[model samples]
Target chain A: AQSVTQLDSQVPVFEEAPVELRCNYSSSVSVYLFWYVQYPNQGLQLLLKYLSGSTLVKGINGFEAEFNKSQTSFHLRKPSVHISDTAEYFCAVTNDYKLSFGAGTTVTVRA
Target chain B: DVKVTQSSRYLVKRTGEKVFLECVQDMDHENMFWYRQDPGLGLRLIYFSYDVKMKEKGDIPEGYSVSREKKERFSLILESASTNQTSMYLCASLSQGTNYGYTFGSGTRLTVV
Candidate 1:
């Protein structure tokens, strides 16, 4: 079984400020990592994923995440944030066919 | 765009009533999943099907059952709805390989009274 841990429950940042949301996972076998963002009353949309290759994965909305194997971390980062970026973010891991998700991190970008 | 559609956006049901949440994917994906999302708990998988009539239990499958008679449709069933079962249910589908991301439905908010 695979599991994901989102270190922070909530993070507040001022608009145009940089922010990072930490995530870690535990898996016995090789896994794929993903970041998903959900806006209020809407479904989740894929931000980015780490299947293989470059450790740094770039996603939409100028978001990027670094996959650190030794640390078992896939942290999401944005150089500057907008109020539109305020949403609930989830980190997920999948080993074979099933996906394991983290509790989630709520990012609040205050204007 | 790949679209995953859930039958209802909101549903109110009495306790002990049978509840069915339907999900349909327009894409011919091989894997479909049913999950419930709760505050501070993210999304917990209830059941997933790799193919028609093939189902596998997920992390929180104790209170739910699933049916996948067709390739594009997956249904989540609550035999007896309880107050605790009231939550937002999400459905997602993915292709066979690992490169594609799962497309999710808007979700169904179920309230048991």
Candidate 2:
């Protein structure tokens, strides 16, 4: 069975400040990792994905993540955030066809 | 662009009532999935259909049932609605291969009283 863990439940950052949301996964087999962002009352949108390539993956909205196989982590980061960037972010791992998701981290960008 | 559409945005049902949530995908995706989203829990899969009339149980499937009658339509059914079942229901679709990502619907918020 595969599982994902998001270390932070909530992260608050001021406008123009950088932010990072940590995620870790446990899987016996090889896995595919992803990051998704959800605004209030909206569906999830894909941020970035790590299939098999370079460790660094860039995504929409100036978001990026690095896949560290040794650490079993795929953490999302943004150099600078805006007030509109406040949303809930989720990290997911796919084991075969089933996808395991983390608890989610709420990012609040204050003005 | 891929689009997945759910039938309802908000629904209110009484306990013990039968409820049905419909989902349709225009991308002709072969895989369709149903999930429930909660505060702490990001998204828990309820059921998924790899093809028409073929369904599989996901992480949480005890209280829900699913049907995929056509290639583009997948439905989630609640035999008997309960307060605990009230949550945001999401539908997603993706291509068969690994290179593509999932496209999700707006989601239906179901509240059982």
Worst 10 residues of 1 chain B by lDDT: B95-104
Which 10 consecutive residues of model 2 chain B have the lowest summed lDDT?
A: B94-103
User: How is the predicted docking of candidate 2 categorized under the CAPRI scheme?
Assistant: medium
Q: Write the per-residue lDDT of candidate 2 for residues B19-47, one digit (tens) a residue.
A: 99999999788899999999998899999
Regions of candidate 2 where Cα sits further than 4 Å from its true position: none
Tell me the DockQ of each model, to 2 decimals: 0.86, 0.76
Q: What overall lDDT, based on C-alpha atoms, would model 1 receive against the true structure?
A: 0.94
Q: What is candidate 1's lDDT per residue for B11-72, written digit by digit as tens? A: 99999999999999998888999999999999999999999999999989987999999999
Candidate topping lDDT: 1
lDDT of 2 by residue, A30-84 (tens): 8889999999877898999998889999999999999999999999999999999
